[model samples]
Target: MSIPPPLQLLLACLAVFSCRHFVASHQESGDWHCDPDDEARIAAEFRPGIVTLDGRADDWSNVDGFEFPLRPALDPDEDHQYKSGKMTVKALHDGKDVYFTLQVDGDYVYSKGDDHKCPSVALMFQIGDSATYHNMGGCKESSNTCNSTNCRGYEVDIMHFSIGNSIPGRLYGGNSVNSVGLVDMYSWNPHCRNIDASAPSGNDSTALNDWKGAWWHSSFSTHPGFIEDDSPYGSSAEKGIYYFEFSRPLRTTDLLQQDAQFSIGKSSKFSAAFWYPSDGNPWHGSAHYTISCDWIPMDVISGLTSQHKAASGNAASLFAFVLSTAAFCVSIFVAYMVSKNKSIPFTPIDDRL
Candidate 1:
């Protein structure tokens, strides 16, 4: 005797549905599996005054760092070219302040124009729980304009440092810009003339050519504070690798500049990107290239927070629960099918009947 076709179809449909659910769940798990290299746990080192803000590699010898491979622009155009490089980032906190050392493997292209030279680097960070996109907060509305409001309602902190004394020379600046809020910018460039112009060269070899520091809010039109603490130096032996060291008070009373808060056990999301001029001339000729990394989970360089531990436990528990539920449902269906097939009584064919 043959089983009914309807019953066979029902069992097949149940099996298909179970497999589909399992695959969908698997895909959802990938969203949370951050790249191992992108994620880092920073440990606290209480050594104040040891890590000086001098552009030298000697101070960072003991600190552990992560190497991030830099790729060309995701979308290359006529103005932007494709380039490859690597950046090594090291971080250590002295209980009151966090210090970062960034080393780039490229030539420090120095360009001289009518009145200035050009060489610079910028480090940007997302401070709080805001912004949907990691690269520049949001998309541009037009070639020359960006709708600051729609770009993601978060602020990005930028520490821009440049060398040389061009007519429009780049300077050491601390800035915070938001899509919905006013822009806060501060700089130590003599070109801005916000502060008195000093000689273009530092007393020591590690100092910049000309430096000025000032803080601004709402627009780049005013200066509020004059604080210059960041330093940069080029490598003689390695040629192009430039090292920059930055340090600041953990918390500041200054209202114009944004201060990033760090807790012992808590974590924050951090990302970085870089820009390089295409030509040696600061004013004309060469195009520029830019690249960026997706946001990574960064653990505070102190101790593991209870929240992080709880999150890990919750993820494991949720995965197990889902797996167990799927298995239980499948088992029930299998048992029902077996019982229904057994219940179909066998009828012996009798010629007299």
Candidate 2:
């Protein structure tokens, strides 16, 4: 997994110079404390083909969502919470991949090619055993000293989507490092974030983004399609909800253990974050709003596949048919037995006496 010396040096220099991620911009506040909502658990139902991942909520009308107030990531004070509305998070899983939708009410705002001016969102999940929701995996190592060997068991997987440079309803993120704006990344701590396969050591050539996402704002009247020419697709400050859709495979071939592998019937810890340019003011990375101050639990529900469901239905029908046939045969047998026994009319008790 080690990279060549020259390439490693080049990547190291890039990391030291220009690869600081947005999550790494966390500004330390005083002691962090949180009383997470006990009922704030997301369930990814086994709903195959129910979601289209088109950044639209019409298809997710039947799916249930967990809503949370968007509070400042650094300061969870309720008084300063986002005034628009709570974020509604919905999730579903086909047998192959898992999908997520994040919807939040916000005035339409778009700044083409400028992510800081447009709205953005990110999803973080626990990958290592000891990773905490705080501190982006909460590794104790400083940026200079942090590495896979030292920060072991503190990995977290992250998927960030910035709609600035991306076309509305156009999919982004993949196996390559060059994603539009939706990138799949992992980290040991805020200072130790890296794109998949971009780690200094344990460089996994096979590692890919493993994430695809699209975005849309309810203000946009034309959701049938959108092209790059449709920059600033809708009017600014238009009242509407913003929809972000994303999907990733349930499992990946990530030998470096950077990806959070999901399994049906299992539980994982995760959190959601949103960034917005309020009042046309560009938002900084540390100034975003988060769903919770701590990790929220997510469950990948196990469900029967379509084929299995069909088979179960057939089995039920067959059982019903067999039971009915058996009942009819038993009735016939009872009738035959009664006839064979020779029906005799009982005489009155007085006559018998």
The top-ranked prediction according to lDDT is 2
Model 1 misplaced stretches (Cα beyond 4 Å): 1-46, 73-84, 112-117, 132-135, 139-152, 166-238, 254-259, 279-292, 303-353
The per-model lDDT (C-alpha) reads 0.40, 0.83
Candidate 1 at 40: error in angstroms? Answer: 5.8
Displacement of residue 203 (Cα, Å) in model 2 is: 4.0
lDDT of 2 by residue, 1-353 (tens): 43344653444343333224364448766887677788898999899877887898899999888999998887788988899899999998987999999999999989898777888899999999999988899999987888888999999999888888888887787634336677677889887888676775556556677899988888888857988897778897899999999999999988886899999988888999998886687776445889999999998888865458778999999999999999999999999998979978888999978
Candidate 1 backbone overlaps, count: 7
lDDT for 122 in candidate 1 is 41
Record all residue pairs in model 1 with backbone atoms less than 3 Å apart, i.e. clashing: 42-301, 44-301, 116-166, 117-166, 188-212, 188-213, 200-209
Report lDDT (Cα) of residue 69, candidate 2.
96
Across 200-266, the per-residue lDDT of candidate 1 in tens digits comes to: 1211111111212211111121123222221122222224465555554555443322324456546
lDDT of 1 at 246: 57
Residue 255 displacement (Å), model 2: 0.7
